[model samples]
Target: MHFVTGGAFHGKAKWVMKTYSASRNMEGWFNLYEAECPETDQFETSLVVLEGMEQLVKKVVQENKKGTREVLQKKLQSWLEWESDVRGRRLVLIGTDIGKGIVPMEEENRRWRDVSGWFFQDTAMAAERVNIVWYGLEQTIK
Candidate 1:
């Protein structure tokens, strides 16, 4: 599995798709969040809807606060199912803009940044490879 992430509008999904398309391997999965709307596409893609960064963070926080190995395993299982059923590939790309810096507002914005950071970290742990995009450049983080 591969996890590609970076700040908002940093082009992480773009780079991952380009790389995936260029790969000689015919079998692979691509899942993108926020970058595209969640509707069935002919091509393999899983789009997760979070509404906004705040909602996304809240989900992460709630998950973490309720931490359990079983819960983590279940999350991983769900991801794998998407890869298999939706994308049909052992190699998978889960893309998101989880590295965006904190937004200075109230508890909501701060919580978003913190929760997103943790989400990225968890994704990286689950992925065999992790890439961070900056200025259209790809840097391996794992």
Candidate 2:
């Protein structure tokens, strides 16, 4: 598992496409904003890219009416099932750094940001490699 993250519009997608030579194969891109998230079995490729993951997690938090710790953990565990669908040896997860900047005034919005940050931290811990792309430069953190 590889975690690639940076600020908004930091050319993360471009870097992944270029670095992985994705144009050579049919790369699967999972967009979080879609009405229905793509099923893992729907994709077959050498590279599986989960884009807008922050949004996906935010949506999950929003949908969980209880917002309890147990509920959150169960939701996250279900989401992690995608890890099984990583094509070949690559599963590049791209998330926006939501921890930067000021805290939100709305409690719900703030919780979304906090949960997203925690997810990123945990992903970095488990990832075999973590890369931060800033201004088109790559920095390997782990």
Candidate 3:
């Protein structure tokens, strides 16, 4: 699978969409972390481990209260299963602002940075190929 990543405004999303559109593979996953989305932003890398753990706890509780835990888990499981079951080439696009320097802020911003970083790490481990986008340029990180 092809995994693409980059910081904000780096054109990772555009590249991923373009690449996916040009490809013939029908099985692919697009995971995007846009700054506009609070959840995505919360998953950044700037937060400490303890902060991340706390945020995860809060998220679990929030999702559970909304009765969305099962649904989200099921979807994640299905994606993992698909990743394993597919025989032909597969593509997975994961976009984030990884290399962007830490944001100078407290609490919320820090939490977002931490979470985003964790998500990127997990995605990279699961992907076979990893590409980093910077200034609209692409670099292979894995």
Which candidate gets the maximum lDDT versus the true structure?
A: 2
lDDT of 2: 0.73
How well is each residue in 5-26 modelled by candidate 1, as lDDT tens digits?
6656677656755865533233
Badly placed stretches (over 4 Å) of model 1 are 22-55, 58-73, 81-103
Structural similarity to truth (TM-score) of each candidate:
0.57, 0.80, 0.56
Superior by lDDT: candidate 2 or candidate 3: 2
Worst 10-residue stretch by lDDT in candidate 1?
24-33
Q: Could you tally the backbone clashes for each prediction?
A: 0, 0, 15
Model 3's TM-score against the true structure: 0.56
lDDT agreement of model 1 with the native: 0.52
Instruction: Summarize candidate 2's per-residue lDDT along 24-137 as a digit string, tens digits.
Output: 235577766563455556646656777787887777778875553455455345445656545354677888898889999998888888888877877787677889998988
Q: Candidate 1 at residue 21, lDDT?
A: 59
Arrange candidates by lDDT, descending: 2, 1, 3
Question: After superposition, which runs of candidate 3 have C-alpha atoms over 4 Å from their true positions?
Answer: 22-77
Of 1 and 3, the candidate ahead on TM-score is 1
